[model samples]
Target: MTLAAKKKAFVELGKFLGQFASSGSAQKPDVLCNDPFFAGLENLIHTAQHHNGWYTPEQVFFAVQSWANALTPENLDQWLSRYDFAEKSPKTVALILAGNIPLVGFHDFLSVVISGHKALVKLSSNDQQLLPFLAKYLVAVAPKLNDFIEFTDGKLGHFDAVIATGSNNTARYFEYYFRDKPGIIRKNRNSVAVLTGKETREDLVRLGEDIFRYFGLGCRNVSKLFVPKGYDFKDFFEAMFAYGDIIHYEKYANNYDYNKAVFLMSRFNILDNGFLTIKEDTAYGSPISSVFYEYYDDLSDVTKRIETDRDQIQCIVSGVIDYSVPFGKTQQPELWDYADDVDTIKFLQEI
Candidate 1:
């Protein structure tokens, strides 16, 4: 299929997804293959939690909406405009997806097929349902796409290139296993925010979305906060209170109870606002229901530190920091917002 054909298929898929949200789902008759896919997708959204406890309907809907916003013709064209897709031979690219969040690895799947290569996807067990369903939808829109997408349950083989996402340990295994082939091995990376004690209440509340969304499972979620020395917690805690209802989720509440107990037992000086906990720590990756914070003496020094440790960080959320993703926008990454600062499309084109 031509690039335009492939792009058009995804654009249709996006329109289908746009009909569903956490608030409710409505079938759009104009959406391609809606008669067959609309009800199935709505069911999937409602029951995703049964397959994976973290895949709440709200979270799944958010993921669906995010992809709906991204797969527009304008956005697709703008992103692909930077690349030359001509004169390239097709290869089978193996994708080892991560299930930390809903549809976490769809971008890689989209990248492989849209670049005129076949995708051999090994869906994360935690995320087994959504992509295959969408793959079916894509094939329905463009029958040729059937030849370009495959899902594997057993050991992956017969792939010319690879993209794998996992924790730091598994990344090493991938590096060694795929050493001979062209590959992109992604490791664990966390996002953080720098607060200068001048943030508006609205900024801080939006920052709560960066922290609590997906129950803080995504790499894009801000797990740490860098604040000026002796920064008051009064306003910060108040801003976080806006998301207090997050505690109603049993899994999150369990983490809060367990982590709070552990902290109390360890005599750690932690602050809690009923649902979330904030502790002063030097680490960037914090546990669920908890956010680590540190005091900074100088913004310049903090910037240099973040620059030096860029590999360990996925995103920095701040209005003041240069290149930082604005507050509340970490999860709504555009097509060009390559994960771990590695461009998947470029990697595929090169391979």
Candidate 2:
């Protein structure tokens, strides 16, 4: 299929996704191929939690809405305009997807197909349902796309290049296994927020979305915080109070209880507000239901430190930090906001 056809198919898929939300699902007759496909999608959205505990209807709806907002014609055009797709031979690109969040590997999948490459996708077991259904939808939109997509359950083989995402240890394995092939092997990376004590109540409240979205599972979720020295967390805690209802989720509540007990038994000083915990930590990755924090003397010093450890960080969120993502926007990455700061489309074109 031509690039225009692929783009049109995804735009239609986005419109299909727009029908779902935590509050309800609505079917618009104008959406492409709405007959049985829309009904199937609605069922998937409602029953996603049955397949995965973390894939609650609300979380799944949020993910769908995020993608719906992203896959507009304007956004797709802006993102693809910078890349040149000339008379290039299409390669079979193997994709090892991550399932930490809904459709986590979708950008890579879209990049491959839109770049005129065939995708040999290995779906994460935890995320087995959504993408394939969407793939079917795309094929229904543009029958030619059927030739461009394939999903594999067995061992992956016969691919010209690879794109893999996994934990740090698994990433090492991916690097070694795909050593001879052109590839992008991603490892564990977390996002962080820098606080300057000047944040408005609204800003911090919005920041709660950055922290609690996806139940703190996605790499884009703000897992760490950097605050000025002697920062009073009273306002921070108060602002975050709005999200206290998150503790009602059984899995998150379980993690909160377990982690809190472990911290107490270890004699580590921690600040808790029943639902969330804030503990002084130097590390970036924090446990679920808790966020790691560090006190910084100066923003410049923190900037220097972050620059040194850029690879370990996925996104830096702050209102004052230069080039940092704004608060509450970490999870809503634009089409051009490539993960690992590596352009997937460019990599696909080159390989």
Candidate 3:
């Protein structure tokens, strides 16, 4: 398909997705192929938690809505404007996805398709249905797309290049296995927030979203916090109360109980507010149901330290950090906000 055709197909998919936001879902009369897909997607969104406990209806809807907001014509146009799409013979690119969050690897899939390459996708077992279902929708929107997408449950084969997202350990194996091929292999990355005591109550409230969304499983979720020395948690804890109901979710409650017990057994000092715990630690990746915090004596030193360990961090959330995304916005990444800051389009085009 031509670039224009591909963009049109995606914009249609976006419009179809736009109908299903976190608040609720409704079918749009103008969306193509809704008879076949609309209800199926709704069922998937509702029952996602049955397949993976973390994929609650609320979380699944948020993921769907996030993509809906991203795949618009204006966003696609601006994101693609920077690229040179001079047509070249299509190559088969293998996609090894991460299922930690719903549609976690869809961007890579979209990148391969829009860059005019065939995709050999190996779906993450944890998230098997959503992306393939959308791929079907894409094919329905533009039948020519049928020729460009394929899914595999077994070993990937005969692909010229690859893009893989996985934990740090899996990333090493990917690096060794795909060493001969041009590829983008990603490892574990965690996001953090830097806080000043001067932050407004509203800022802390939104920061709660960064901490608790996706149950803090997504890389974009803020797993750690940087606070000034002697900072009090009284106000921060109060703001986090907005998400207290998150504890009602069985899986998250189980984690909170288990991790809290483990922490107490180790005699580590932790601040708990019934549902979430905050501990003093100098680490980026924290377990679910908890967030790690470190005391920073100077904002400049913290910024310098973050820069030094840039690859380990996926995003920095703060009003103060010059490069940071504002609180609560980390998970809502634009198409140009590539994972690990790796430009998948450039990589695909060059390959």
Candidate 4:
């Protein structure tokens, strides 16, 4: 398929999904939640609910709608149309997905499928349903795609290229396993924030979303913050209180309780909200449910510090900068926002 044709197919898929965004719910989101195969995704939601963290059919629907909306041709043109994929097509592509966030590897999956390559996908147990659902729908929209995409639970054998995402530790494993192949190896990365005194009350609340959404398990989640010196911590505290509902998750609550106790036991005077932890640090990443904060003497200095670490960061969500939307929405990405600084389409074309 040409770039224009692929774009059209994706837009059609997006529109079809958007139609369900209003009132329908996924029948079974779980069976396919960790498996990227059409068989598992056929009826996914209900079967997966008992596993962990509450995710309703309605929420899953919206998540799909949000993903589809972002991938529509219009949005794709805005964020990702720069990469032309007509020339490079891999004979085979292996994709390893991250389950930390839902549908995290969809773009890569689409890039491979659209390029007419056979895909070998290893589903993330944390996020199993999305890819298969998408694949099934793609086959429905364009039957030819069926011959191109395949989901698997086995090893990626004899693939011409590979792309894998995992923690820093797992990255080492992928480096050894796929070392001989042409591929991109991504490691554990955490996004951060640089807060200025000018932030408004609403801005702080959005920051809470950036921190609390998906229980802060996503790479895009802000695990740390840089506050301008003398910045009133009260603003952040009050803002986070607005999202008190997020603390209801059993796992999240447990994480907070455990971490908080550990802090007190060790005489760590870290700032916390019973949901997040703050401390003096120059790092960008944090654990699933904790946040770290450091006060900076100057705003420019903080920016410079972060710019130096930009290569290590995935996305920067901030209240002080003039950017699109607000915080918690960082993971609710726009179309074409490639993850880990790798453009899948471009990679496909290069091969």
TM-score of each: 0.99, 0.99, 0.99, 0.86
Best by lDDT: 1
Clashing pairs in 3: none
lDDT tens digits, residues 1-351, model 3? Answer: 799999999999999998997677788899888998988999999998889989998999999888989999999999999999997999999999999999999999999999999999999999999999999999998999999999999988799999999999999999999999999999999999999899999999999999998999999999999999999999999999999999999999999999999999999999999999888988899899999999989999999999999999999999989878988898899899988999999999999
How far out, in Å, is residue 94 in model 4? 0.2
RMSD of each: 0.7, 0.8, 0.8, 4.5
After the best TM-score superposition of candidate 4, give how far the Cα of residue 285 lies from its true spot, in angstroms: 2.7
lDDT tens readout by residue for model 4, 12-68: 666555544436534334221223433344245444444435454444554666776
User: In candidate 1, which residue ranges exceed 4 Å CA deviation?
Assistant: none
Report how far off residue 324 is in candidate 4 (Å): 8.1
| Clash pairs, model 1 backbone | none
Summarize candidate 1's per-residue lDDT along 202-254 as a digit string, tens digits: 99999999999999999999999999998998998999999999999999999
When 1 and 4 are scored with lDDT, the better candidate is 1
Q: Write the per-residue lDDT of candidate 2 for residues 301-346, one digit (tens) a residue.
A: 9999999999999998899888888888988999999999999998
- Candidate lDDT scores, in order, read 0.95, 0.92, 0.94, 0.70
| Alpha-carbon runs more than 4 Å astray in model 3 | none
> Which is superior by lDDT, 2 or 4?
2
